[model samples]
Target: MADKSNKFDEKLPFEAAIDKAGYGLYSYIMTALAGVAIISFVCIVFASTIIVPTSACELGTTGSQQGLLAAGPVVGSLLGGILWGYQADNRGRRKMLLVSLCGGTIFNLVASISVNWIMLMIFQFIAALFASGLYSMSMSLLSESVPMAKRNLVVLLVSSIFLLSQGIMAALAIPIIPLPFSFHLPALGIYWNSWRTLLVVYSSPSIITIIWLYFMQESPKFMLVKGHEEEALKILRVIHRINHFRSKEEFEVLGLQQEAGQEAALTSSVKEQVAPLFKMPLLKYTIIMTALFVINQVGAFLVWLPTIADQFVRIMQTGENSDLNMCQIINTESPVDDSVTPCSLNETSLLIVLGVGAMQSIFNFIISIVVNQVGRRNIVMMVTALCGVSGILVNLIPSALGSAVVFGVLTLGVVVVGLYTAITVSLFPTQLRALAIALAMTGGRIGSFASIQILNLMLVNSCDAGFYLFSSLFAASAIVASFLPDDRRGKVAALAKEETHKNELAIKTGND
Candidate 1:
């Protein structure tokens, strides 16, 4: 048979073939593209946090309305997460990402021209509905494309970009939102101001991501698992050629092995794609990861960090020397008029946000460097527990500077997001990986939406309670993270075990 002829040369396991592909420029480019995808998704979701405040005068947004606007992306992403995950597993990661990015960008552009806060919220929700695919799928594509050795570091680095995006938005806002230019549109009955202009600028990453991803290859692992071995081999050859700067013919990976127990036929139904994650071996990881996501994503402290910073600055501006805990400082009546007027962001608050983002990004990068050595499980436990302690400390800190520092530490929960993602990639099988992440993210989005809404109420009535609640959540997360399987070696052993099980089943079937 032609298959026998194809096997004339030595073949490699999937990981071996990935190693043979070599690490080089192509790998760096894939990592960069994945980072851009993170920037796009993070900016799109959080853009309203900045825009709602800056545009308060023009949009006539109340505090409650602003909270709802902030929740829109979470709600939309929550709704779309499972659907996008199902499609990504079924349809292919690259193709679905292109569709989602293009669609999200178009809707995001439409959001810029909105006449009112409600319209803006609606459009942003729709945009997030499309953009939701980027969350898990981007990680899926990047993890599958790169060699396994670089996988954890590269993924964490990209997650650092997610943290950096807040600063990116702040840096972008520093120049753009303060621009003293406005144009009135008589027909639409709204003023075209810097905030609206900023939304347009925010959409640029998705545009750039779409263009880059269009030229890139589908995850070869996905291809291989789906029984397109020839196509997968071709991609590996291209990777080898580009990585080594050598001819494709010199790449001697003549064949690739299917992952142990990989389903050759694509699962056509949503149930088929999702069911595996809830059964037997994968179920425990799903439960733990989802719980961790829910706990970490209770974003009350983080969502309100900027507002607290701005409030702290305002309080200090009044020459009040009395040291106060977070609740006291935030709840203290400021001497200045708090009314929405001609829009402006405090330079100090902007700096605080930028600083927090910068610190987190650097920390994430450092984690990327040492993660392979320290191990993902150990890192997750330490960082998450640190976040819990910080959250508790944030409420106790009386000094403005101290509170800001602790808030930065509290926000370290963002780092855990990346670790959980890396864990999920290693924990789940290729066929179910995207869907499993999507399901976990669905839990996270719900947590975010609930946390934001709950915090809105708590920050008004009981600020300390909100901090205590989130700290408790983080404490719980750290406890759960301790149980994770050693990701690196576990993945290899799991594959070999599955292969042995399959062989035994075949032998038993043959005896019958």
Candidate 2:
């Protein structure tokens, strides 16, 4: 259909043509759309952080059970990350994303109506199984779709969608949870309160996201690599036409084209595609990225920061113990009062939690704006170092501001994840990109799983030691970040070019 522009693809690869198409309204629109999907997924993961404990009172959940509720989504992600990653690489990112987001939202609604704790847990697990795919696949689609020059800041901002969701959740929860409303269904023997209502309120965006993706095209570069040259060029023109409305008449790319001899390797068996990530320098890249993710996830300051907001305030107000540590302040029991009704809010505690989330979200947006100038590696190192110092000060200085610094530093982990995602997306070919990210991010998942267990063991019995452990890990990760090449300026794109060239050569030689 893109007859006039088909020759553009023949003469110049889709990747290069896309670079020529450059950043425009269409690119930003897709960025916003993809960011929304990420927001939905992150909302599901974290919304439970608030909803679980709130429901625990009526649900008769023990502290351990509450922990499980918080971790349920992570467990689901651990199980599905690799599977979804592999699917996106083989099946098409847009298709996998639709399946993930739509499917997750339906089950999240089911979870809201869950009659029992086990039922809710099971529902959440199922929801995460689908939702988890969106995070990894969204990165693939956005990084590949956007131009190289804009990707670092773009991916950083997009990855920060989770932080943004936290802020939104906090802002929305205040009014919604305070509504003082409840809905009960006798047939199902269920009673719903403001907390449960919050789930549907927050998660409803996934429906909008699904509808958006329904009209959105797959990554044009992705289509080109898989032999859908016509479709790819068509998408490129649509993009150009959107961004270049006044000059639409001048849009004359002929069609999608691979480099010379690239057409032969358009198709690949799953194994042929997956095998490369495990071999060569790609393996090294995957390992380092995974480690960084692990550190970020293990020390998920943002998640635990809210839990400790009240505690941090308490310590700061009293200045009681010079020896007190972060885990002592943060990793504590549930805020539930058995004397009160289930799923009910403790006004002060709830507000504090919400406020912390809102503040963190705002900080994330500020970081995204500044990261373009500061450079990602510097941000990672600077934050990790500050986190370590905050860990020490939280122990030594028992001040309110000290606790705030720790909270703010924890937020940096989100930035590191964003930077890693942006860089890694550039380093791999499209065929293996999803799986590669999934595998790398799986490190963070595993780290989260371990961190929870470790914190549980150490936070209460040995606070100072726990504080040192987390802070030291961040310190170590900072050193690691120092070694990671800063690819904010076309480094990933350069790697992608080489990989594309490699893919073309393999296809031309019939090696696949």
Candidate 3:
């Protein structure tokens, strides 16, 4: 029966292959991945704002020291991405995700009980490694499992949930800290700080994800390649039973059968599975998409919208009229003069950040709709150009218009970010998709790390220079984005097959 099913799939058209598999399975997998993606985003964004600020305040660390602490994740993420990507290509997505999530949960727990700043940094780096791995693997699995027609929408939807995680972190940070109970080290007799408490709270979510994922099945595509026909058929039957609300007989009628005697034929090794990714056509797309990924990362890093928003608030308070700059605001040396109402740091700035985050999700939804229609290259170029322009405006805008325009520019910048993110997901093939994304994301993290360091340096002198520096990075990203190719909508498998055929014919002709 398994053999018959495999034969049926081999004979079916590309679209038919998608249709034969149960969409319900894809949906379930994507839903799970989306949850993990959100957690990953929350962990990173939360660490940047809540953890860094609290740790720095507690330790009396300098701006540069804070910058290094902030960059710890990116440093770990770069290494983790390459390691996990190679693992996914070899071991499979489901296994890697579970491993990564479990690792992340343990590391975050350790981080929450750190003895010193050094231990805190080390644990954060370990947590980051797992988080980065989880992120890349989830997206790659989603891409491979979904149909061509629905892939863009699914990828965008799954990725967009990461935005909501940021909001969740913000909401959680307020309540978790200043709690009555805190960890105390008997050896040192010092209670664990609020920052440590926050880490403990944040780490709780990963425990749920880790347990839930253990019950999940492997991707049908991965199973097929690995020659696990019986297991693949079982998964397909379950999916079919769920989707059609019927039994195994109904699933068999739908042509979800395994190929005859293909178990012996299915001898393709892991090396064989990955070798095509480096060959022609696939290799070309990989290079192009990787370059775009690097460019987008550089732009994303420089346009740290949250930090810029903070600076905007400071500038608004200090510019010409107010007596205080950021230092005075932080140190509270002089009582804020009644005549000068310091910009309210409550929901207003938070709302602006939320608005920007929402705008990014909205733009992602828009790209999901139009990506197949307008093509990937054009959308990237246009959005990247807008991003560059918005960065410049963000730098140039005087802080006089009371926070409203600051909010608007930041929101616009986020929209551009969404646009670029959508393009990145669409450009790579499933086999190499996760690794490509990891590399790209890691590159972006590097850019972000550099931006943070630069911002810290400039904050010592002038806040304005940081915004200008960010703008320059976006401008450079736009220049790089213009060179990418369009149209990543068709079947990657079919493309690979066609390339293989062409190569065979060329070799035959050369031999003749």
Q: What is the C-alpha lDDT of each candidate?
A: 0.80, 0.70, 0.57
Candidate 1 lDDT over residue span 1-512, tens digit each: 57755644566777788887888878888889999998898678778777877878888888899899889987888898988888888789999999999888998899999998899999999889988879799999999888877888789988999888888888787778767688989988877888889999999999999999988889888889888899999998788788888544466677887655565335335554555566655667789999989988535565665666677777888877457777788788766555523556766777777887899899999988877667788888888888888888886876866876777777877888888898888777777789889999898888889999988888889888888887878877778988876544445457435633543243233223
In candidate 3 the C-alpha lDDT for residue 469 amounts to 57
| Segments of candidate 1 deviating more than 4 angstroms | 1-9, 246-249, 264-268, 335-341, 487-512
Give the winner by TM-score: 1
Task: Arrange candidates by TM-score, descending.
Answer: 1, 2, 3
Best by lDDT: 1
Q: Cα RMSD to native, each candidate?
A: 3.6, 3.8, 5.8
For model 2, the superposed segments whose C-alpha errors exceed 4 Å read 1-10, 259-266, 310-375, 486-512
Clashes in model 2: which pairs?
4-254, 5-253, 5-254, 5-255, 6-254, 6-255, 7-254, 9-257
How many clashes show up per model? 0, 8, 11
Q: Each model's TM-score, in the order given?
A: 0.92, 0.87, 0.79
Residue range 253-357, candidate 2, lDDT tens digits: 665556554344356566666666656656667777888888764344445444455455545445454345455555444443455454544445556665655
Angstrom error of the Cα, residue 430, model 2: value is 1.5
